[model samples]
Structure formats: structure tokens, C-alpha cells
Target: VHIIICFYSIVLLYPQKNMPQQSEAIVIYTGWERHALVGSDIRLSCSFFSWRWTSDDVTFSWSYRADGARDSIYVFHYTGGAPYVANKGPFRDRLEFVGNPGRRDGSILLKNLDYGDNGTFTCDAKNPPDIVGHASSVRLLVFEKVPIQAGVITGAIIGAVLGLLVLVVVIYYLMRFLVARRVFNLSVRSVSLCLGLRSKLQLILYGLAVTRCFFLI
Candidate 1:
């Protein structure tokens, strides 16, 4: 009777702990806003702001996708210094773990980023001993290189400038001719047409110059 009473009292006083409270896990990073050029390297950095939990049992993995496929584009698992390529098809060699996974640094570098390598990449943390944190995502934008023809852009600008100079010379000669023919009224329409043509030509040249600037960028 006494034992039964004590057991009942213990049960009432405290409930069994199925699981402990989850620890707070968060990822922090910066410098991922600007557009990444094609055939260049892209670094997806993931840093743990505050990892209060103690667990080496947790598995660190990274999943990435470029084409929004039904499945993960690529997945890497870090067991030790060597990362296991769990699901790497196209990004076999191009993908490299920048730092050790055992630490909080979860940055990854993808070398020679191709056109197909433009998409969002996700960093996942799973199976933590105490708390399970959600994955973080980074959007990647790849800029395509403009295909400029050999000398076509420069040629157009130079041609436009030369043509404008020639037109100006012709206009000056016509104005002088009209001034000498004091009885003749200068056709205002002709002057307006020449100015309009010059403006249009200058705009075209400016467009070409802008394209060149973009190419250089």
C-alpha cells in the first residue's frame, strides 16, 4: 500500500521527458547579392551565429538546384574531412567544400560556374541531437556574356562620328552658299532636317558606346 502510494505520488509530481527542449540554431552570412559572372567561381557561405547545442552526431549536408528539378540538384554529406558525394551528377568535380564541416563554417565554392549553374542553393542541417534547424537558401544569378562581333561595335561608332562630321561640313557649305545668295531665303526645313539627322546618328553611336561599356563590365 505504501509503495503504491509513493509510485502514484511520483507519477503525479513529474512527467516523463520524451525529449528535451530544442536548442536555437541559426545561419548568418553576407556578400551574396551581386550577380556572379558566368565561368566564374561562386562561394555560398554559411556561418552559424550561435550554436549552443553540443552534438557531433548531427549530419551536415548541402543541397543545391539550378533548374528547379523535382529532386535536389546536388547533395553533399560531410562525415569527416572527406565529403561524400551523395547526389552529385553534373557538379561532380566543380563543387568543392571550402572549409571543414566539423566546424561552424559551411561555405562551399563552385568553380567555373556555367550557364546551367544559375539557381538557388540550400544549406541543410539535419539530425541534431537536441534541436533540428531549418535549412538556409541563397539565390544565385548568373550573367550571360554578350556576344560582340569583331570590330562591328567600334566600326559603327566611328562611322557614325565621321558621317556626322561630313554632314556638318556640308551644312556649313550650304549655309555659306545661301548667305552669298542674299536674295535666297534659307530653307528652315533643310536646317531642321540636318540637325534631326545628326541627333539620330549621335544617339545610335551612344547606344553602341553603351553596349561597349556593358561588354567591359
Candidate 2:
């Protein structure tokens, strides 16, 4: 009788653990804000990182709001093993499902970007009990591609300056070498030829001036 009572007491003291209490925490990682040019495409980066895989009851929804807008527009949604896209918004037929929610990939592709599409994008995911940290948002800035990129313009200016500096340095070294090595040793005949050329140039100029004055008179 005492052994039976002890067994019942042990069973009462140690009960089964609740599954919710032992569930792993969720962690959604949405990448940083992206800056893209208009008329170009961009891939939204979103992935969940956790020890446990959320393969069951998976759902993903994406929303966006313009820079000065007060309300967010529903962009895309996926649930019950199917995908739904925005049918009335500008993103209709623009959102491409490029991620696998079964494998923790919740990314998407935004094609033919527009200027008004510049806004904050929210990526929300849910998998039953592991749903709190499954939501994250990022900002996207779109601009006209007609403008030059700041990095490219800066690089071009820097390259031009460097090329000019290299040319100047080469020319300076050549002149310095000629002076230091006494490489410009001109013979008597070379000096005579230079003087002859100078005198001929002066005579030609004088003749041209005289002809101009005679024509005026």
C-alpha cells in the first residue's frame, strides 16, 4: 500500500511538459533598405533564422506605404499553400514570387519599378505558435535612372585628376632627367640651324606686315 501511494505521489509531482512552453523562438531577418533606379527591378531580401523549421501553417504577407502616405497598400499575400497578389494596386502583375516559404525564404521580386513605389515594405510571416518574431519591414527608395550615380561621377572625376597628375609627373621627370644628365648638348651646326630658322621666321613676318601696310595705302 505504501509503494502504491508513493508511485501516485511521484506521478502527481512530475507532470507532462506543455508543448507551447517548449516551443522555439522565431526570428525574422529582413535586409536593410535598398536604393534602386526607376524602371529597374529589385529583389526583396527576407529570411527567417531559427533552430526549428516552420513548415506547417505558413503564411506570408507584404505591404507597402509611400513616403508621404498615411495608409499602407496591401502588396502581396501567400497562405494555405497558395499565393495572392494585389489586383487593384500598382503592384498588380509586378510582384514575382521568388522565395520558398517552406525553406525559410520569404523574398519577392519587384519588377518595372516606379518612382511612386518608393516606400517602406513590411514582410509578415506566421507559423502557428512561432509567429511573434516572424515579421520585419524595410525601406525602398526608387528614383529616375536618368540621373548619374554619385559613385560613378565621383570615380570619373578622381580618375581624370589621377591621369593628369601622372602625365605631369612623367613630363617633369623627363625634363629633370634631361637637365641632370646634360642630354641636350647642341653642336655648333645645330645652333646655326636654329638661328637660321628663327631669322627666316622673323623675315617672313616682316614681309607680311609690309604687304598689309602697302595694301592699306
Candidate 3:
């Protein structure tokens, strides 16, 4: 009787001990914003991190809210190694699944973008026991021509400055070499003139000595 009572007491005290604990929440990552020209293609990148092991149960979802739209709408869904793209949305035939769930990526490629496609895109992911986290969002801007990025502009300016500096250095070195060559030529000419004058003076002195010897004889 005492054994039965003790077993019942233990069961009552720790009834949830054998239950599996929930894992850490999933963390979704995405780029802040992207720019693409109209009629071009772009990749909306997304990935996730989860404490639980990745499995076939991992799923991805994409939603979109057009500029100034009040509500967002689902555009793409991925589960069980298959994708279900919306058939009658702004991204109807333009969305492609470019991510691998096993690798924790949920990115999608947007093709033939239009100005109407400028909007915010949200990426949500779920990995079984790690399904509790906020989704990541990225903004897309479609333009007639993609604006130059600040980094690109800075790099161009830096390259131009470097090229100018290199040209200046080359010119400076070339001028120095020309000046040095001219100075060498002038020194050679001066040395040649001095040797000519010395030879002429020696001949004149020898002729004078011969004249003096003739006079003495």
C-alpha cells in the first residue's frame, strides 16, 4: 500500500517532467532594401537560424505590401520540398523559389519587375519547435534606371583620384628624366668644346716653338 501511495505521489508531483521542452525561436534575416531597374530581375534574399535541427517540415512564406497599401498579401509559400505561388497576384508568374529549406534559406527571385512592383517584402520561416519569432522585411524600389549606390560612387571617385595621381607621378618622373638627359648632353658638349680648345692651343704653342728654333739657327 505504501509503495502504491509513493508512486502516485511522485507521478502527481512531476507529471510534466518527461515532456519535450520547446526549442529556441527562429531568427530570420533579410537585406534592408534593394534597387532594380524596371523590366529587370532581382533576388529578395532571406535566411533563418534555428536551434532545432532542420527537417522537411521547415516551411517558408513570402508576403508583399505595395507602396501605400494598407494590408499585405501572401505571394509565395514553400513546404515539403514544393512551392505554391499565387496565381493571381502582382507576382503571379514572376516569383521563383531560389532557396533551399535544408540550408535555411528562403529567398526568392523576382523577374521582369515593374514600377508597380515597388513595395515591401516580408519573409517568414518556421522550423518545427522553433517557430516563434518575428519575420524579416525588405523594401524594393523599381526605377527606370537603378540609382548609383553610394559605395559605387565613392569607389569611382577614389579610382579617378588614384588614376590622376598615377598620371601625375608618371609625368613628373618623365620630366625629371628628360631634364637629366638634357643636363648630361650639355655637360658632354662643354667637355668636347674644352678638349677642342686645348688641342688648338697646344698646336699653336708647338708652331711658335718651331719658329723660335728657326730664328735661333
- Full-model lDDT for every candidate: 0.68, 0.83, 0.93
Query: Which 10-residue window of candidate 3 scores lowest in summed lDDT?
Result: 15-24
Which residue pairs in candidate 1 have backbone atoms (N, alpha carbon, C) closer than 3 angstroms, thus clashing?
A: none
TM-scores of all predicted structures: 0.49, 0.59, 0.83
What is the C-alpha local distance difference test score of candidate 2?
A: 0.83
Q: Pick the candidate with the highest TM-score.
A: 3
Measured over all alpha carbons after superposition, the RMSD of each candidate to the real structure, in angstroms, is 23.7, 14.5, 3.7
- Per-residue accuracy of model 2 over 1-217 as CA lDDT, tens digit each: 9999999998788756532434566777787678788899999977876666576778788998889999998889888888889897888988988989888787899999988888899988776666667468899888775457588999999999999999999999999998866644656568889999999999999999999999999
Ordering by TM-score = 3, 2, 1
What is the C-alpha lDDT profile of model 1 across 1-217, one tens digit per residue? 9999999998787755554646565554434443577889877776554455424654556777766666665557665445676544767788787854456666778788777776777776533543445577777777776455457899999999999999999999999987877544356667888999999999999999999999999
lDDT of 3 by residue, 1-217 (tens): 9999999998888858486767678899999999999999999999998877897889999999999999999999998889899998889999999988889998899999999999999999999878899999999999998899999999999999999999999999999999999999999999999999999999999999999999999
Better of 1 and 3 by lDDT: 3
Ten residues in a row with the worst lDDT in model 1? 25-34
